[model samples]
Target chain A: MSHGYQAVGWSPFKKRYDLVLGGLLAGYLALFSLATLLLRPEITAETLLIRAFGTAALLLLHAVLAIGPLARLDGRFLPLLYNRRHLGVTMFLAALVHGALATFQFHALGDAPPLVSLLASNTRLDSLSQFPFQQLGLAALLILFLMAATSHDFWLAQLTAPVWKALHMGVYLAYALIVAHVALGALQDERSPLLAGALGAGVVAIAGLHLAAGRREAALDRERRAAGADGFVEVCGVDEIAEGRARVVTLGGERVAVFRYEGRLSALSNVCRHQNGPLGEGRIVDGCVTCPWHGYQYLPASGASPPPFSERVPTFRVRVVDRRVFVDPRPLPAGTPVAPAVVSESGGGG
Target chain B: MTPLDVATWIVRLAGAYAAAGLLFALLFLFVLRGVDRIDPSARAGSRGFRWIVLPGVAALWPLLLRRWLAGASEPPEESNAHRRAAAGGRG
Candidate 1:
């Protein structure tokens, strides 16, 4: 972190990552173009550009969407998550090329402007098979453009992390629109079933990965939830929590991070105020609970960021009895200071 | 009015909005010193940074304006209690 903004804080690793990504994208386009030329020599240059770029963009989008779930399911995929914004921006550029070429070829030099033609050319909105597919594609491109444009830390910080995240969730809407665009437009004309089958498979793969990850997280939550007496829920034993770390427990539908630090225990909402990051997944650094995604820090007991930073998360009352940790289900307001439960000498042997 | 006329009007209005947005982004970058809102590591004031975020600022000026006005205020309270209770308190 510096005092001012640079174009990018590119590290050796990030540079390497971009190099690999560029090589892969270039190789894919070249191979796809060469294959198409040999296979369909009669095809016009415009059609070839449209098909090649469109397919590449679609594939890149699928890869981008899959990255989050894939990273969650396996630690090995975490490296891909580091520079995902670059990949997204590249994908948007590909989509832009495809859209521009398609518009010029089909809609330019006509009586109406391209945007108007895109919307009005196919007025068959009522027909499912012949719906105005160009409109769907245009709408999807707009969303992608918005996302790509804001894919920087400046926007993330200015918009605040939560608002920024919510805005970027427009990716899902874009994905749906693109799916409809392809199903109604290209699939209607193409004789081959390969493209259609691939689209179906891509959707299924993305959905299946998310479902599996959700199930795994749910199961972990179930295992951690054990109700104690008097509205208190048993998180793990004190022994289960590592020093400077936390045991995340889901009780009454709320995720709480029960931290063990300096012979004291405190429970706070697991969500980071900065980005809704999993605070429980992070460890205490410099005497504060550091968020793993971004280095936003908060005191364990108060759930408040250190002085001069106003961010806060909800705090919960926690108790330790006979080596076991129990947390009150009700959460206090953000920045509320609850007393930390000291670890007794007898129970602190772990 | 004919459908063509309506279409032409819509296109013209969209163009006007885009031009206004570009102007706003430039104002924010230079006059407002909006680059400070960016993370410190990225606040290098590089030409590349301006080039990259220009399109985003143009597209999302309304949202950015709201945030800039809010100015370090506490985050809006989340109403996830119902969902948390439904999920058995697992957020």
Candidate 2:
């Protein structure tokens, strides 16, 4: 039997039906539970199922949001990135259930259908604690619905990458609204300190992860600027690099790696395209620079060719003037990464 | 079957289905970890957290009351046999 091990990579395929059905089931279950709770029906086996599902779904949403920063912080968690859409859609469905049950029980009874009641109910908008958290849930659900609908590659292809990315950013807005919904609706009535603390912790953890990532990115930017060849006044001797050793230099606003081999020096873009790994920290292995993180190798001479993969980094022209290496700030074409470009004692004398 | 028998069967069926759903959900909790492993992109960690923490506490709760009132004992008999065998071996 052929072990049909599907090559595990980012699945380009969208799970439209799973999201759709899951959303419907969650919405119905929530409405049913809310209706019974408001009516004060005897606590039956059905009530137990509803409570468990609601609790589980709420926890899952928090887990899903945490996965994004967790993955970015560590590459091992990249697996979560590939299936992020599934988690998001599933959580949306769960929240929908809670919303639906709520609408049916609280809003529907003596008026138009539950959906109409939700739309028409504007009486509680003025009050702080009395604000219809259901409306907030509705708004959040609408945003999630839009996101879940467009999560497929088909929709992604229809919407340009920029538009798709912009649309997906609505998740932050949805999350904010959901927080308000819970604070006003659930916590207001329940007054459970444990639940309130859990919510607070979730918000803090998610925000902290993003803030930490932003700080790291800012630091990387600083390092990139300092390492640029032009950032350093022509160092006393550009020829300071020992054979096979790479020197980090700054030129203009870009970081470049200057390496000496066979009495010649070459400059290459110091940033590894994969996660912006530090090319300076990497060592030359068989004439190829290997990234320390995932072992993505690039030819130091041309900055290309780790075959079956076709990505190129920019290279710069370097000239030695009285042992001082001067580099032209203009970047070479990405594919024209010339490995081991001839370095000379006189600027551009090669 | 009588109407009462049919009614009883329906109730039993519902209970069985609910139990099945619970069992499936528990198995899903474990299987999710498997799915997470098979498709590493699915979940974060191993699926045994339920067995390690939830099952022990939840399953033991009702058992505690059952044994408290009835003095239910079985493992003691098995252990007593082992103790007797050890003592006999020494004697």
Error of 2 at A347 (Å): 20
- Model 2 agreement with the true structure over A1-350: per-residue lDDT tens digits: 01112222222333553454467556756775776577666766444453545554566667777776676577576545546666777777666675666665666585454555565555567798788677687888778877765554323322433456678889889889888977887688674497789889989998998888678646654743222545334432655677766777555455667767666776667666543445654567777776543355777667774664554566666666566665654556554655444656445434
lDDT of each: 0.80, 0.57
Candidate 1 CAPRI level: acceptable
Docking class of 2: incorrect
lDDT of 2 at A71: 61
TM-score, cand. 2 vs. native: 0.50
DockQ of structure 1: 0.32
TM-score (chain B) for model 1?
A: 0.65
- Quote each prediction's TM-score: 0.83, 0.50
- The alpha-carbon deviation from the true structure for residue A301 of candidate 1, after best TM-score superposition, in angstroms, is 5.1
For every candidate, what is the interface RMSD in angstroms?
A: 6.1, 30.2
lDDT of residue A156 for candidate 1: 59
Q: Write the per-residue lDDT of candidate 1 for residues A125-201, one digit (tens) a residue.
A: 79988888988899999999989988876665666566778988899899999999999999999899999999999
Chain B TM-score per candidate, please. Answer: 0.65, 0.35
